[model samples]
Target: MNNNKSISVQNLTKKFGNFTAVNAISFEVEKGEIFGFLGANGAGKTTAMKMLIGISKPTSGEAKVAGFDVYKDTEKIKKNIGYMSQKFALYDDLTVRENARFYGGIYGLSKKQIKKKTNEFITELGIADIADNLVGSLPLGWKQKLAFSVSLIHEPKVVFLDEPTGGVDPITRRQFWEMIYKQADNGTTIFVTTHYMDEAEYCDRVSIMVEGKIEALDTPENLRKQYGVDSMNAVFLKLARG
Candidate 1:
């Protein structure tokens, strides 16, 4: 296991009954790198992420996340990682401050730490005025940003984002990416799954899964050149069609 790598997997596989969701796939994510996990629906992206995040157990092969073995150290993995699903997992009824406190408690943060962090986060995001408002009343983009902040309350080593920018306007998406870039700059490895090809361009490296297998893995520029395409959309179309 390389100490500098945040995630390492070799021939990692998962099956449901007789169907193999993720075939023998191998990959490594370096510390602070923005790794893009791309694939069409049912292409095994979700299944693979579940295994890496320590929620879904693999049927065979070896894998490690945040330097902990997936088979034995799932609890540790969960503690050292943050996850923001596509659904924007925030309590709609809770106020911004309450949500922060809720997640902080779950991550075993001290009350003083939670208060300090919450103040910093709200001030940083410029949401201090609405800290007491119900989350359901905030705009979608604000909620998305808030959820992301909550995910980082414990300062996890890695953050997994599942289509995090879905349904947001172009400006909101760009703003979200800026936040992602800031996190990566601070040494948090970001492993994200997305269907948006345009977003793929922002990744340091991307792996495209086709039919439960990683058919292509490389930087966006290299992939475009290798496939003789002008954009990631075309690159994905060319590979997914085959």
Candidate 2:
């Protein structure tokens, strides 16, 4: 997996005032891999992800995302990655195509490229009828899907999803994961964070954070076996008890 390493974290740490949000975590994400980042509330998963994505600088240690150093090359790293936060980062007042244009422009996508990709995304998502409709008029599921597509408008090498399926129904979550799988199959590295243990099984490999440390990391099968548990929930229960 050496050549496949798309993101590397080494003893990364982040602090706020006197509290340590992310405490010395290290890991690597391979290219074309669906890497699951799992954690409970206040476990520092989001903090670690922020540092990796270059929005939050590490307090100590080092990290490289898409081959750019987190400390000094944030701009370069920004160009190589796309991000979708749980809060749905989109313009509610803008139409679907207009929203796409706004995000595409921010990522420096050429006008021609944005037009081409917007058409393709609308056709694939079967949302051409509402292409000109304001994003606020769309359903939650449709907005989530469109936000994902817009994030990738620049064709970034890596995409980070922070609880991308947070408020969706079970069916929509399933559908969202399917889209993530398609992108992974197309050679895009997917670094996702989720609280759903069931969704963790769908990842190529998963890492569980407990109090800002990677307490468990492996394929679903191996993790279950190692914990002597039949399901990820049981494994998580055991870990949480410790």
Candidate 3:
């Protein structure tokens, strides 16, 4: 394992019965890089992410995350990664402070650390006045931002964000990416999956999946230039259609 690589996979495969969910795929994500993982529905992107996050085991081949082998060190991998689903996982019934405390406890953070994070969220996010308000009462954009901050409470080495901005408005999406950029700048490896082609441009590097395999992996500029397209949307449409 290379010390500089946050995620490393080679010939990684996941199968169920006779069907292969994720075909043999290989790639590496450098530390502190924002890597965009894209794919259409049923493209096996989620399956591949599951293996990397230690949610599910791979059928064959090798994979490593945060310097731990995926096959044997699943527990260790989980401890080093934070995750946020596209659907958003914050507890609607819990207030901002309560939710932070809840997740902080789950991560084994001490009371002092949780209090510090809650105060940071209240101050940094400028939501101090509403810190005690229920999360469900907040706007979708607000919840999205809060959920992101919660995921980093443990300060994991890598974060797996699955389509985090799925239904957010443009302004919210931009704000969300700013937070992402800040985290990346702090040396956090970001592994994000998004359907919005424009979001692809924000990534340092991107990998597009098709039929359970990574069909294209490169910077957005190189991808556009390679496909002779003007936008990532066009690049995706061409690849997804073909």
How many steric clashes between backbone atoms does each model show?
0, 0, 0
Clashes in predicted model 1 = 0
Regions of candidate 1 where Cα sits further than 4 Å from its true position: none
For candidate 2, write residues 1-242 as lDDT tens digits: 36679988889999899998888888898999999998888999989998888888899998888888999999999999999999988899999999999999988889999999999999999988999999998899989999999999998899999999988999989899999999999999999998888998899999988988889889989999999989988878788667
Better by lDDT, candidate 2 or 1: 1
Each model's lDDT: 0.96, 0.91, 0.94
Best by TM-score: 1
**TM-scores for candidates 1 onward, in order:** 0.99, 0.97, 0.98
**lDDT (Cα, 0-100) at 145 in candidate 1:** 91
How much lDDT does candidate 3 score?
0.94
**Arrange candidates by lDDT, highest first: which order?**
1, 3, 2
Cα lDDT tens digits for candidate 3, 179-238:
999999999999999999999999999999999999999999999999999999999989
Q: Identify the runs in model 2 with alpha carbons over 4 angstroms from their true place.
A: none
lDDT for position 12 in model 3: 95
lDDT for each residue of candidate 1 in 1-242, tens digit (9 for 90 to 100): 77889999999999999999999999999999999999999999999999999999999999999999999999999999999999989899999999999999999999999999999899999988999999999999999999999999999999999999888889988989999999999999999998789999999999999999999999999999999989999999998999
